[model samples]
Target chain A: MNYRGPGRVRAEEKPMPEILHPEDCIVKVLRSCICGSDLHLYNGNVPDTRVGSTFGHEFVGEVVELGSEVNKLKLGDKVLVPFNIACGKCSFCRQGLYGNCHESNPEATAVGGIFGYSHTAGGYDGGQAEYVRVPYANFGPTVIPEGMDLDDAVMLTDVVPTGYQAAEMGGIQPGDTVVIFGAGPIGIMAAKCSWLFGAGRVIVIDHNEFRLEFVKNYAKCESYNFKSIEDPVQFIKQTTDWLGADVCIDAVGAEAAGSAMQTITGRKTLMQAGSATALFWAINAVKKGGIVSIVGVYGPTGNLVPIGNVLNKGITIRANQASVKRLLPKLIDHVQKGTIKPKALITHRMPLRNVSDAYRIFSDKLDNCIKPILIPPTVKE
Target chain B: MEKIAKGIPDIKDWGIDADPENDPTYPMKPNRTDEEQNGYTWERSVQQAETVEILKSTERPNLSAVFGTSVPPKGLSGAIRRYAYKNSEGQFSHWLPLLIADRVNVVEGIIDDLKKGKVPNIYAEKGFNAMWKYNRKAAIGMIAANVAAVSALGLFLFRGRIFNEGKSVKKALQNYNM
Candidate 1:
């Protein structure tokens, strides 16, 4: 699929990949996902989201061919690849900080390599096609464990780890009230994981009624439509008896919808990098000396934020790309133990050829689509 | 390494001839044309009457067998090296493990290229570049930090002479005494 322009995508036939390096292997893609981050590119929100580039960061595949130097796998190994393309021996990878890998994305300094995101993230073609060249196959691809559901493994690639990390960064204490801003898949996952971190109360805020209801049922947390509430911050303060929640999470990111001024300045006019309405709310709604964890992504440029409030309130803000490789082992255990239901988020699955239709449904929020997966035509159900 | 193809003759003269009149390190002067000097003498290059037989050794040269496992420092020295690796985010610290891993990848990449009858440049294949060239902003920041640090150190060391200049040691002492 080629990203022709904003709101335009078309499928084009491309040649098969050959061995570029000894560590490279070709994987026949079985499953790929259209992530919320991809919307940033599809909607022309991210810079340098080049035309004619495939966009997908979450995928699972079968290793069909291996380069001469690939030692970890044989032919026919079904693997789950992390979204981040990190060389295992880099300093960041050695420190379990694979998201900031040095060698994989030598083209830029800001971000490590990410598959199919954009040029700012190494410019590697993603797994949205029938086949993709898996660089550093030995290090990146993990064999799907026996009897593990493929859907669960695919979510483990990005959504589960990111959500888990959001909660982990919040450092939720026992009896602490946590407010998650967003009812998207990651936000829902964060709300669910907040319970594991000993949060006494979990409240998810979003404007979408469908997603709000979905999170309430799936995450088993309190959900509220921000549009319905007179003032979200004031409501939260009143509910907590004027003492704000202990932790606030911003899972909404740059493409947030809320305040009129923010929408005008951020989304419509392109004055700010992205709509930071959720981040502003999180900063205002958190208790003094509380934590504000941000897994939401912002553009490369600066954005309007409440820095003074954060400093005065003594808020410890922690943000980072989820180190998927580092979290995979523990998350796999969670999936096996039935502690997390990652596949429940998958509301739509379409063939890779119908990707345009899939994107439209997901982007428009039609039919209450929370998550969408793309199945390559080569793979049978 | 895999042996060269069977049909290809091994050249006897791998090293250039030395000029006795000049320094031993310097090779003989090249006067012949490019084609004449390095002509492809496929058949005659392999001398048939050589008495020295090539030996196929049974045992492989193992570094571990020759010199046991690496000797890790057990005292303060080891702690200091570990601390340096842990605290520093410089290129040296970042490149150490990558050097080890890329060494094998680079070699295999070269070997594969050779098998396919292509000359491989390891530097390009490995995507290796100096830190300064790779990240100029970081390099400039490091250079600026070093300059500031050195200037501060110089000021600290020469503080008395620099700040208390124009006051003679004897005259100043006498004034203080009076």
Candidate 2:
């Protein structure tokens, strides 16, 4: 399937991307996952990738080729591509923050520009193609642990790591109240992280009843429908003794409407997905002397923050693109120990040729699908 | 000295001698005949020897000749005496009068000189003090007139109603011996 325009996909043939750098490794797609962000671009919500950009970010694949200088892995290694591209030795990566490496993209941050995005991430084509060239493969690509299904490992590229980062950055301490805004896939994943992180109570808010119900049932978190509730902050406060939640996650990113609920008590933390607007509200909603961690995607233009307010409140803000490499090992351990079931989040699966339909179904929220997996045509059972 | 020179008139003799008590019959001086009052009374009274001495030593014509045929002098003393007193009269009634009027002309000239340019070195060092005396009198007169008009208006309009009430109140209290 080919991405032509917003909600416009057609079948087309194109030359496969080849290894252009010594650190490059070409991966043959085994399975790829559809992200909510991809849906935003697919539905023309994001302006850059509207016309014929390959559209998939979350993926697991096997290496088919490597450049001359590549020595980390041989061909036929199953790996998950990081959502952000990073060179391991840079200052950011040396500090275990690979999302902003210096060399990943000299023009941009080390945050992986997936297979199908625009020029912001070095204009390196994304992984939605049959064959994709991975830059800085030695530092960026992660090997899928043995016996793990490509479908489940695909989420490690984006969703699992992003959700986990949201929870981690949100400061979900033991017995602390965590309020997650938006019941989208990332929001649910954040709620799941809160539960795993031992939050005393995990509350999820969304305007979509179906997604809210999914969060309530699957994530086992308290769900609030913004549409049904007259006042979400008051309602959540009533349960939490009029003191707002200790941590709030704005996983819905730019799509989150209006201002976030103001946190009156405790050390409030806001975990932003990919929205500068969410970061703005998160900055406002946080309590004085609180912390805000922005894991969302920031374009070249920096987000406008009320610097005076942040300074007056002594509010600390930390932001980086999602660093899957740092969180993947723990997530993989959770999966192996059976503490977390990554596959339970998937609601749709289709073949690679039927990718256009998958985009439509997921992008439009048809059938209330959360994470949809696309099995490559060449992959065998 | 010199026997007090009773008939010799000096600079002090150059003035009008109008004595109201001496001429109390009409309260005015009666007009006298040209011969009696010719030249001046003081000139006719001077001694002949002094008149002749003054006339012979002088370079100009005799005072009798300068006075012409209007009134003949009684003698040589009369001529010199008439010359001295007539000179004093001339100083006050004609040229001296013009000199007084010329004081204003000199003041205007000084103002013109100040307006035209800076005071010349010669005038500032020599003439400035004498010129300023007359200028000062004129300036004071102009200033006093302006001040008097302004004060009169102010006292008439402002003090008449307001200050007069205060004055009347004090007067009433004084009448009550308080």
Candidate 3:
């Protein structure tokens, strides 16, 4: 369908991409997801959502064609495409930092390249289409294990690993106190990963009662509805004996929910508290000498950081686009071992042709949809 | 005496000869100069007296502490020779085991690469550089392998004689105890 404008779709015929290199593979998309980041492009809030740019990035597909050097994967093999394009041999890719691959971007200055961001990434088409070309296919695509649902594995492409990274950056160690801000899909997933990592207390803060319930029941994390609580940050600190949370994750980026991060982190500057505190709160809320990992999506303009607070706190900060290639294998193993059931996070599923409707329903929060998996209509039963 | 003379030829090739032309004697005459000839005569006389003294001392080994592992007299010519050869060769020979181990490690690495695929040019270059950097190690490994092979052969050929020598040492010790 041609993207004419916001909320408009039209059927248009376009040439399918062929294998241009020995490492390339053509995939027939099985399942795809509408990311919150994609909503930015769809709503025209973020620039570069052009007429020809395909929309989705979180996707699972079957290999339909393989280039000469594609030996690891074969035709008919099911796989998940990582959101970040990586060459697998570059310095960044070698260190499992696939998001920052040197070759994926045309400019070669920045380390990361996002799918569907033509100006930011390599301008390679996205997985919203029936077929997509994957460069360095063996390194970029993760083969889904047997008996795993394509719907469930699709989240591993972007959100699951992203959430996991958020938890990781928050220093979510076993038996450590953790507070996760924003109970969105990513936030929920981050909370779940923290629980899985064995956090002693995983407290999730959000205004949405439904999301809080989901986190409490499904993720088995302590939930706090910020609207219901008189003082959410103080309450959490009081629960942890005023030491502050050992780890804090901010799943909400620079959105309205992010304003609460300062309060959650005890009024610490976003940078001072480090990326970990920035993950859940502003940098100031982070414990001294603690780690902060920022997994949330920042605007192209970037956030106004409190550099002084970060310097004073001596908090270690790390921010990166999710490296799904490195995280997918471990997440898959966890899923196979029944350590994590990402399927529980899926609140809705609709056919690919109905993706526009699904987007509206998800965006509008209709029927409390958290994550809606989009299955393409063309797949055979 | 005849056996010693036959061994002397083999020893000369090992850089231990004492003759001027065949033995590489010191104070070598460039063109048989008169001064060099006189100096050579004096050195030979001094060396001959020293050799006689060494032979006399060996008759009473217990009285000669230098003949045993005990420290030799400082600045003695023979003592200096013993220290130089023993210390240098002993310290240098210690590297043999390490060299052998490294070579084994390299061979294992090469075998692993061969099993995977043809070794890349980069790997080959790395291997070449590694060998160049540790050439002395490689030489020590070669020497160790040679020594091991020679020792094994000697043990196989002189097994009965080796046993006899062990028995003789034990008997001598027992006699000393009595």
Report DockQ per prediction, comma-separated. 0.01, 0.00, 0.00
Flag clash pairs in model 1.
none
Model 3: per-residue Cα lDDT over A51-113, one tens digit each? 445667888899999988788899999998899877665544555677866555431134355
Give the whole-model CA lDDT for all candidates, comma-separated. 0.70, 0.57, 0.58
Deviation in Å, model 2, residue A317 alpha carbon: 3.3
In model 3, the runs with Cα more than 4 Å from the true position are: A1-13, A230-232, A258-280, B1-178
TM-score of each: 0.68, 0.61, 0.61
Clashes of each: 0, 11, 21
Look at candidate 2 and tell me the lDDT of residue A266: 8
Off-target runs (Cα >4 Å) in candidate 2 are A43-50, A109-112, A257-287, A296-314, B1-178
Superposition error at B165 for model 3 (Å): 99
Candidate 1: list runs displaced more than 4 Å.
B1-178
lDDT of 1 by residue, A1-381 (tens): 556555555555667755555677889999999888787777666654544567888999999999787899989999999998777664445656678665555334567778887655655678898888777777889999999999999999999999988887787665578899999889999988877665667899999999999998887788999889958999889889898999899998888998988888877665666789999999999999988889888766567889999999998887888889888998898889887889999998988877776776676566688999999889999
Error of 2 at A52 (Å): 3.3
